[model samples]
Target chain A: MNEPILRIRNIESFYGPIMAIRGVSLDVHPGQIVSILGANGAGKTTLMKTVSGVMDPEKGRITFDGQQIQGSEPHKVVQKGIVHVPEGREVFPLLTVDENLSLGAYTLSDKGQIDHDRDLVFSYFPVLKERRGQEAGTLSGGQQQMLAIGRGLMANPRIMLLDEPSLGLSPLLVQEIFGILKRLNDEQKMTMMLVEQNANAALELAHHGYVMEIGRIVMDGAADVLLQSEDIQNFYLGVQEEGARENRRWKRKKTWR
Target chain B: MDNAQLLISGLANGCVYGLIALGFVLIYKATEAVNFAQGDFMMLGAFVTIGLTNTEYMGLPFWLALPISLMIMGALGYLIDRLIIRRLFGESQTAVVILTIALGFVIRFAAGLIWGHEPQTLQNPLAGKEIRFGGLVLGMEDVAVIVVTILLTWGLYVFFSKTKLGLAMQGASQNQLAAYYMGIPVKRVQGFIWALAGVVAGIAGILFAAKGSVDPTTGLLGIKAFAAAVIGGFGSLPGALAGGLIVGVIEPFASRYVAAGYSQIAPYALLLAVLIFRPHGLFSQVRVKKV
Candidate 1:
């Protein structure tokens, strides 16, 4: 029964004149991982962008930490401690890895705390320390994603919004990334709102999940219950066998109240 | 004057051109818009020095007046950014360029009205003093230009490569949005860079005036500086200097041997050739945009 840290009420966003996101609402509780599962063009990225203040929503209210944040500038939003790791791992390509990390702490004024966070980020991604002098663009896809997340951490945010950390990574690397994410959530009790196309994987890791289809949430429930449901099996989990569906139905019935 | 002396004079002039080009490149890197008023800024700096040194006015010594002029020009640059350039933020690239061009006209016309069209000579403390060095007679002013240019260029190199503020400016130039996310106050950095460029241009103007005369029409130095910027690859600081020197040296040689009438056009011709052969300029880093 913890209070929610973020609330979105009927928010709609547009790109120029074209409506990209319809009235979408969700809640992210304190110290919980909430996953927004969707296919491409389902407005998942748009929703994250709106929350991070990159795109202004045309309608609805977004409250973070009890303050209305809709339509705020991106930099101001960042100062309020909602750090966004944007899509495409947009790390400053020309900057050295260490310099990139320093930029993440741009809003921070304390020299000691900035150094402490730098150490924390380096420990989380040991490879970053090894390649701190190299340009960020020189890193591999998995390493860049780690840098992006590490960069988000540098903001000392209350919540981290990650957009497809698995995008463009190999299966093994994706697994490694998700493992780190789980560790951050479980060990540090860090709050996260992850937008991912990998629905099965995202649902498996999330405490609660919301399925987005064409700019609206179609299904939302506890992750375990959704994982056992027949609808999720057919539409998201890609299970077609009759025997498997029957077993999933039984598990759903048992898991549901 | 011997051929060697003419070559030395040309080299000195080239150094001034390079310094002004550096100013253009510095501002262009930060804002991505050429301040067409760059030359007028230089002219203003010289005028301020002229006013300070005039017997009827404050009549400050040349050494004191020089720094004061530079400081005033830097402040003027900061004011321009706050008043005009900042308003043009998020404007289309073409609109920004056109606005700057208009600003250039405004500045030049204003200077003409204020100072009148007469060319005035700046009194040189070391005027007519020439040093003989193995078949080349170098004027004291020429030596001053070379020494000052080298020192300024060196200072700039250290600032960019070593300082935190310098790196932040570079980061802002590369990606403004990303720079802001990292906590760099992008607007302040842009203003600082404009001010820096103004100071550099001011130094160039004072030197140029010492060697020759200062008139409202001296703002034409901007066209040569623009050519230098183009030659250096519009965003590269060192490239601007190199480009200026190239134009400076080549124009005089062209005037003496090739065609006196075409001397003024030499830099433009080089600019056209560079554009055709190497669009990025001789020293610019090639930038690739992501989809």
Candidate 2:
């Protein structure tokens, strides 16, 4: 019943002459974790890009916290308290971890507040604090991802768009990271829109879930509903049964186009 | 006076080359574009200083005219980024490289038209003065050059590591897209970097003019500085100074011991040798881009 913090309505995005996303609509309410699950080339990443103002959509509207922000640049979008932890964990390689964290608070001028927020980040990722003086490229993959998320947190964002935090991590590490994310959301009331291919882990953590196929949302409902559905189990969950494989494939194939 | 004196003089000249090389590395770091017009900017700075101080031109005194010329070149640098360089965003690397080379010629010819082709001496407070110690003698200007170069290099080092704005510029230079996502105004930073490069080049130009004379062809000195940058690991700040000193010392020593013609090609030969052996230069840290 809570009002949505971010609302998307029939948004279409294109790369050159090819359409990357079409009529993709979703909602993220206050303090809720919403996950978008899709395979490669299904436009999941493109949706996050459009929402974070990295690319302009050709049609429809994107409203973040009740303001129209469809075509704004990434820096302007960040000013509105929408921090994006982009895919591949793009940390500045040559910079020290401390320098990276300091840059995250670029908009803020208050030294005291910046220091306080940096300490908070250090608390969340103790490894970052210990390796603060080391170059960011020296950190392991898991630590770099943590630093990327921590950098996003330093901005004091109202909402975070996380793209594949567990892209190349071990299963145990994925669970560990998702556990931290859940605790942060519960304790600090942080809103998140996660794009993921790991449906089981994502659905276990997120409150709401949307299934994307070929640049459009195919099914969306409460996380439990989507997780329990028989179709998601066969295709996305990869727990396919011999009896239903052919019928499900034909039905899903028809719905795709 | 002797071979030792020649070495000392060569080292002093190397400091000037290093200053100009710093200008090249500054613009290259910020925008990833090798500015071919860097030497031309230095040439233009000297001409501007001379014109401002010339009684026939603006008639201002040397002290008053120098600062004004620096300001003018700084503004010119900012305008170059805004009016020309920005349009080449996302262009092919070759196109941008060629454009800058072409721009260097344009500025050089424009100076030729305005100032005439004749060489003119630049008036300065330290002209023709030297200090004698034992059998060795050093020009006052050489001492000034060495002292000023050290101070400028130290100042730049502190600015990059300590100050907020300088850190922001460093961060942006490393990754502009990431910097933008962090809410750093990257375009404005690019403009500031270009202006800063211009001011540094102006200082080097003024010093070079005072060392001898300014002519339209003076900008060709940028080529030697460019060779120094390549030897120093193009993006390394301190490497620029080291490379310049190496090039400067080698030129005079080669002419004195080897052949008179060897002076002109010594830096180029050293650059080639370095590129063949260690392409990244001695002090450069090799960076691998991650996906």
DockQ of each: 0.35, 0.60
Q: Give the TM-score between model 2's chain B and the true chain B.
A: 0.96
Clashes of each: 0, 0
Please give, for residues B25-130, the per-residue lDDT of candidate 1 as tens digits: 8888899888877887888777778888866656899888988999998998898899988998888878877887787788778877876778876776977788
User: In candidate 2, what are the lDDT values of residues A1-257, reduced to their tens digit?
Assistant: 97899999999999999899989999999999999998888899899889888789999999988899999988888889998888888887888999898888887788998999999888778899999999988888888899889988888899999999998998998998899899889988999999999999999999999999889999899999999987788678977666544444553664432
Q: Native contacts recovered, in order, as a fraction for each?
A: 0.28, 0.52
Residue A214 accuracy (lDDT) in model 1: 77
Residue B210 Cα positional deviation in candidate 2, in Å, after optimal superposition: 2.0
Off by over 4 Å in 2: A249-257, B1-4
The Cα local distance difference test for each model comes to 0.84, 0.88
Q: Interface RMSDs of all predictions?
A: 2.8, 1.6
- Among incorrect, acceptable, medium and high, the docking class of model 1 is acceptable
What lDDT tens digits, residue by residue, belong to model 1 across residues A1-257?
Answer: 87799999999999888788999999999899999987788899999989988789999999999999999877778888889888878787777888888778777778898899999888878999999999887788788889889988898888999899889888898888899899988877889999987778888889999988778998899988888877788666878746544345433443211
TM-score of chain A of each: 0.93, 0.95
